[model samples]
Target: MIDLSFPLREKVALVTGGGSGIGRATARMFAQRGAVVAVAGLDEAPLLQVAEEIVAAGGQALPIVMDVTSEDAIASGIACLADRFGKLDILHSNAAQTGEMQEDGLIAAMDADFWDRTFSINLRGSMLCAKHAIPLLLASGGGSIIFTGSGKGLAGDLDYPAYGTTKAALLGLSRYIATQYGKQGVRSNVVVVGLAMTEALDRNMPEAAQKLMTEHNLVDHLGRPEDIAEVVAFLASDQSRYITGAAIVADGGFTSHSAVYADMLRFAAMDTGAKA
Candidate 1:
């Protein structure tokens, strides 16, 4: 019988952007679930810290300094993973150009260089990583490739046009990979994420803004990094073996409801108060 427990025993996994937030959480979870994780990111400090933390927790981890925007860097990172682990069974391409929301604003005001940079890191980086990792994945007899996408990709937004556009493009890239490599045992899928309470968001978002976002969410609380990590772990494991070329939304119902849902709730509350 197939193992339904979603265990990733002895699997070798790589998580880009594994220094913090969802990537860090997923790397930890993957370790806990029996996978040897290689945490790759641009910064060496956090990567080392995350890897140390995993080691402290009785899991094996390798911290790699990688700049996804550079093909040479990505190729070197993958080579390091292969050198250390011998084979790769799961790859979570979670790195992206972020933290410049204001600069990535409306297309009309978008900086040409900024837009190019966003695509270079967010879209092109993922492609390059896949191109280098596919041979190893196939060597390991097929594996999963999970892309970290965003809800903005599926909906029009007032800002962050470049970010949204790259995320939207990820959906197509994932589908293409899934189609091209499915017969060869590779699976590629996207996880469309919503706002989560990460360090950056918690530090930047105001209380009122958080409250407003919560009101729009169907869930009682905003998402946490661990929440998204769980979804990614599922996709990384064999439990989701039959799933590929699809986008799994883990947005806490942010994209599930109608655009007017939040407003409708407020109007209903007012009507009820008036009747009372």
Candidate 2:
């Protein structure tokens, strides 16, 4: 019941890890909707490339080089953006690192260094961004902050404890932000990404694990970055004005096992008065 077109005009957005993958797609989408986008990433090449594309499309964009794990870099980057844009409206924290592979066991066997690095980028990075971006967003009369998540949050994938833990934590973080700042006119939400075809997919997966990805989805094909982007744009816009403290699963129905779940629930509750 809202006008979705150009809902983000005059808004300024920042997409971290915007060099590639879901972050890049989301930055493009925001620019397409007439928002001034700041593309941030540790790698300047991909970040600049995305910004250039947005500019070529007759959209406004600025490329920023930042290391999310470094609080000083994050603070300086936000300062630069604030100086240029005057205010911040949307912050999409999407940067992350894929932890070390598991050879013979679950994540418990995974390297401790990998776990530490994973959390630093995935969890601490988001917190750092939120810390630096909050003031300007508040000055902009409140805005939306969108976290990039994964289906791993809903269910732990074998051998990926680091990734699963971080994604699941992201949901809780977003919820707290939403709960605490709802009255300030700020919104916080997450896009629970399905298996998307990004570089991260091919590099980290083997033949068998990759096959499992396709079977996991209800849709015929695997999820794409754009699929997640569409949802991100919606949450970043006025269209989702009433949505906050929520995690929208955009996984091509990967989690839509309602019938199977219902039967399981009935079985569980059968012993008691309630159905499982």
Candidate 3:
């Protein structure tokens, strides 16, 4: 019989930016799959809330207030997990700074601080998490390190230069980690995130932009935090044991097609007289 369940029984996971959005979803899913989770982030309240929710559901979890950009904070948070769980089987790096949507302008017009801030959080933060978590994961005999990426990282965008640049850097970082430690049973991969209707997006994303995204997406609607969370859980589990140093696009096919997809659909509708 084929075992369809992806069980993470007795595994321990640490998730950065676990307060909300993709991080929170991932943490919850890990718990559901039998993993003990440490939800770490800059905010204490949200982390506490997540931990309470997991425990209330009869799962193991701990809230750790952490700032990923700080090496000391990352180390401390990992140490906390070690003291509590003894070893780590997964590290999900999901924190990111969008940078100044206004200040992360063209190369000539971009602000130095904006670039630095974005890199500090998205790039350096991910590095710190891996650096600190690998030893613990190694102690566990093997584990997964899943870093979050974005479509902006894979493609060029006119805006958010810093955000895109930092995200692109994460893909390279994953490959390096996978190459250096794959023989030792450590796996690293990048999960390229798509447009999701999170609280932040609902407040910030324009209605027109959402409609345009839906038109281009292979699926009828945009992605969700849960969508990215499931992919992260798979990579973290033994189900993806052989998958390493890969960029898995869980974007509902947002980046799978050409920019002219909508235009082609329009033409097809005109010729065939069929609604697309």
Candidate 4:
């Protein structure tokens, strides 16, 4: 039998936006797998809660309140974790902002400040994290860098253009890191997340929109934060030791079907007297 267990025993992981949603799920999952985790976010209360939960569960965790856009803060957070864990093995740059998840229309409607602020958190922040974390990763005999991307990065969208651009940039950055550090045992990959039903999505998206998405999804459901966390865990572990410079889609087949597939399914359902 092939061993499919993803074991990260003794690994040290640092996750941005770990206070909630996908970041929180991934941080907790990493700790559950035996990795000493540092959960970083702008909110200290939620970060502390996550850390306490991990400790209560018999896992090591540190809550770091740091702003990703600040180089000094990123450096301090990385140093704090490194000092405590002795080394850094996994860096999950999961922090992102979608300009309040508003539909910031086409290029004509986008402002310079909007684009800059989006990139500041989505792209540049990831850069700073990698920049400071790489030295520690290298010192720890190489590790993994997991970036969270989105399907919009690959597909064109009429809204949130800035967010899409930043996500695409992350894909490129991940490839660059993989090429530059693969020889040193460091691996880098991007997790292209789909329409996950995170708390933010629940609060922002209407029920009808979510239902329409579910209808289009090949798996017949929206992704959960834990779904993405599972893949992040895989990429962070030795199971994916040979995988790098890759965009692993965790979208529950959302992008796997053709545009007409939903129609086709509807037609079949109608012929079979099933709900379309």
Q: Which candidate number maximizes lDDT?
A: 1
Could you tell me which 10 consecutive residues in candidate 2 have the lowest summed lDDT?
98-107
Off by over 4 Å in 3: 1-6, 271-276
Q: Rate the local accuracy (lDDT) of all candidates.
A: 0.93, 0.86, 0.91, 0.91
lDDT of 2 by residue, 19-59 (tens): 99899999999998889999999989898899999999999
Residue 219's C-alpha lDDT in candidate 1?
Answer: 94
> Model 3 residue 150 lDDT?
94
Q: Candidate 1 residues 1-276, lDDT tens each? A: 445453888899999999999999999999988889999999999999999999999999999999999999999999999998899999999998876767987778779999999999999999999999899999999999999999989989898889999999999999999999999999999999999799888998999999988988999899999999999999999889999999999988999999999899999999999999
- Which candidate ranks first by TM-score, i.e. highest? 1
Poorest lDDT segment (10 consecutive residues) of candidate 1: 1-10
For candidate 1, the per-residue lDDT at 102 reads 75
Better of 2 and 3 by lDDT: 3
Tell me the TM-score of model 1: 0.98
lDDT of 4 by residue, 63-166 (tens): 99989989999999999998888999999999998446554567977778878888999999999999999999999899999999999898897788899899
lDDT accuracy of residue 233 in candidate 2: 93
> Candidate 4: minimum summed lDDT over ten consecutive residues — where?
1-10
Candidate 3, residue 226: CA error in Å? 0.2
| TM-score, prediction 3 | 0.94
**Per-model TM-score versus the true fold:** 0.98, 0.87, 0.94, 0.94
